[model samples]
Target: MHLSEQEPSSWPQWLSVYHKRALLGGGLLLATALLWPTPQLTTGQRIALPLDLSSTSTHFSVPDTLEALADKPAFSTTITTGDTLSKLFERAGVDQQTMYKVLEADLNILALDTLQPGNEISFYLDENHQLMRLEIDFSLARQVVFTQVDGSYDVEEIQKKGQWQPKAVSGDIYGSFYTSASKAGLTAGQIQRIETILKEKINFARDLQAGASFSVALSEQYIEGVASGDSQLLAIHINNRGKQIDAYQFSDGQYYDANGESLVRAFLRTPLAKTYRLTSNYNGKRRHPVTGRIAPHNGTDFSTPIGTQVIAPGDGVVTLVTDHRYAGKYIVIDHGNQYVTRYLHLSKTMVRKGQRVTRGQPIALTGNTGRTTGPHLHYEFHINGRPVNAMTAKIPMASRLNKAELKRFKSMVSQRNIQMGV
Candidate 1:
């Protein structure tokens, strides 16, 4: 052993150092395997690793997803029941001051009293934080609706019309005429005629019984596919317990009792039935009653009590309504191109020029307002403006009924009468 104790050879010393390094490397590899985890989150939601950790920070690529989230849209509101303009603005999150500005911009826009339910309104903000469109629906009468567009409020009117569809309605009258007519699909025009026809015979509100029944043929008018009012009545049959009636619309304006004759007369027998006298008869050319001079006395003079109605002489158009020293209030009518008539000495003129006057239409009231000693109606008739006696002037009879038309008319009449139980 003493023989070489030779300086612990340098080669052996180097080999010993290399073995120690190999052992340290093996320990580090084992530690790393237990420390790191695979990436689980997307790029947009990536997490940062601590400096003490072996792995670097990583992320997933997700630009498309983030962009979609930022592009979501906003919405506004529409009008609903029991809502007012103030309430509507509040729901849209618009300020009161802004609403005032919008209203000021358009004077014809929505008003407080005209708002209607179920109308749409929109809201949005512009880049400058200002509102753009403001609108209110004004298409319908007595209604208002507001809307917004392009960051402003705009209003448009919605027109609602009653649908005009043919229908058959029948019901019993328990109370008033309106109640009964409403059940029968009868419109205002038809209801008016029904009252006119029955007013002389019965008082609907007082006389209608629970058993009284009515059948109506009529149409209804609708706006925006919504029924609003009733149209004209085509035909009607009313059964009032024992009283029965069938009426048809005639060209003369109202329904008839199976006959074409008008229910209204061309004239009343006298202006006042209680106290009236024929002061002067109609004459083409005669001595004037007041002046006692030869002149054209073209009208009949009826001395009547004050306030007596001076009715129309016939169906005509009012051509003149005037007041003169001699005729305080007077009306002239053109029956046609050939026939004309006049009424004079009135306290009040009930008609105007260019008005259509029906037979028995009240043109004025009697009074001693004109050149007269008493209240009277100075009536006159003329053919082509030449004065004639009104009392003796005979109206041409209506044209004869067409044979074919008459036959059809009679058939309809018979069927209606049977239905009416007449």
Candidate 2:
């Protein structure tokens, strides 16, 4: 109880003893930890836990492994105007022997006979640059394939499944209809079709003005989720100088206006698909080039190359197929209602007398067989036995559809109207 007065030395001794004992205990604990082995846990004895995948993102990729595995080189090209299959094969580095073999292998493969522009042709060549496989796209939905088999070639026709995708385009004309339509992504073929449908109603070359608007509804072909670059025009609406023209393609494959009137005319302005220069006009009392005498130049003259296809301007019965000293080889088509068309100086005549011909049918070939000084086509349009300027004359249109067809056409094209936003 009174140890506070005499515990100074005893306190020092107690503190020293306690410090040594604590140090000894710590060293012993460390030694035990280092010497003892940790217990190993098995899969069955481990605790189950949930994985956290919320913060992770998964991705997928498709590699073109087949293309990588192919040893030969593949070349593809589009057919252009005046392109031949042999020329294409040469361009693809195929040898002449291989080309001849492919050609002689299949006589029924006439796809190369009519080489349409824009068709695709592909070639696969081996290490020796010999053609091993060839693929020709006849159309968007059809292809012909030729593969080397047993030192020969085997041909196979493949039909592709395609879907129709509705497409719509609209634009306003600032200059020419061609320029504006091209800017709106319409091809020349499509523009020509539209012109054919509306030529009777609107003179595109003369009547189109600034601010005139147009809308076109068509279908684009899609195969395997890829567009095949082929399109079909379905419906069109044109507002030209406050006049509205609507044309819809019917199930019968003819274009009809909103009132069910056929857009095809009885006569086409030009007989040839290719445009030509007006060498001479329909004139009376003109000095003849050969005779140097005043003669009546009754027909219009178009200067074109020899063998140019001449088409029937209208549906009519062939009245005369004869050769004269003055007119040379000529054809006379007698359209009813006191109308007649004459094509003079042809190299070949395809239609015979008394044969029925439709408009746009090829009837003859242009030539220099007549008494003319140069190669040209002499076209004459007669009305009631008198020659009139076909380029400036007002040609009559074909008869319109009856009331029942009009109703049905309107009903069938009602959805097209909605799609065109009419």
Candidate 3:
């Protein structure tokens, strides 16, 4: 969506665009003046050279805006470890107001927030030192550019269906699955994802014996021969003794076995292993006791001790870990596939932002940190960006693919199997 900036505030942004081009348009006058091949004259000197517009062999052309931009001081920065948007903008000499403006413009998109340590961002400023354009390169395959339009910013999201280069890594279990996978050129994150996906099928520590082998068929995205950040597992084959196990990732972002059965990895129904008393249920129609308003209870309240352990219900990336005035210390986790989980009124957080967590992993301790009557854990589950009842709502669970999808999956598997030399 394109937002219009207030007419009054639009001057600074469009100044860089219209004014610069206007200055270039003035270059025609200079070009016309250069037609006189006589000796160089000062400002007071007037050379009466008869210029015929009909047959002047010299061509007059205005300079491009890029040529004008060459004279402006350029701003660029690469996101690094421990770098925040504010910190990077500060380093680039941008004020807080401008940063907020950029963020406000990107409220509906997933650009600014998804930037990692390796991503790149640059700012283009006008003569008044105002941000005219901002470009964020997530990878070689994707980019987001914000241009100053009128008074607001225009957002452009660029995505490329990059070429997927299949890679097969096979090796015998050495010391551990992690070590062997690392030796076979798989990243730690990749190995962890595979373990999480096949967790229900095999216990890497206990199931594998001597002479066990593992084969991973994955694909890495690349654009113009440059690798992008889209490595994903496609199919895996593990042979332990006489038992053979295999799983394939279908197009629906779920894994299944050779028989089209789901390698189902569902979130734990509850974050706590040991059940505590349920103090409150998800009541969307409940009224606030103090505020005397129809403030719906969107989360589940579990009455627990101050130091009760809280575990992650699903595999996800920690998106937020902080304190709130009314909610206390809370942690928000983003599980992919439009699933998210939130834990509020926490005493301690075990994971930080950007950290990957698996199902049943300890993530925090329950406590009353916010506006609460007592110590308890408030949990919320979200699907498609809205809070739902954690106690009843269906979490991410894929049982099996449909007939048409299964046919497509078979074709994908056949192609991948040949690629991996299975």
Ranking by TM-score: 3, 2, 1
What's model 2's TM-score?
A: 0.47
**Candidate 1, residues 297-331: lDDT per residue as tens digits?**
65678877778877775666786776655666777
Q: Model 1, residue 60: displacement in angstroms?
A: 51
Name the runs in model 3 displaced over 4 angstroms.
1-67, 70-73, 81-84, 106-115, 149-156, 266-314, 317-396, 401-415
Specify the poorest-scoring 10-residue window by lDDT in model 2.
Answer: 40-49
How does model 2 fare in lDDT?
A: 0.69
For candidate 3, lDDT tens digit of each residue in 320-339?
Answer: 88765567788888775457
lDDT, each prediction = 0.52, 0.69, 0.71
Best of the candidates, lDDT:
3
lDDT of 2 by residue, 305-401 (tens): 9899999988777878876445768888866445678898889999998786778999999998857888899998887556788888776666687
Error of 3 at 387 (Å): 14
Q: Model 1 has how many clashing residue pairs?
A: 33
| Cα-based lDDT at residue 190, candidate 3 | 83
Candidates arranged by lDDT, highest first: 3, 2, 1
TM-score of every candidate: 0.33, 0.47, 0.60
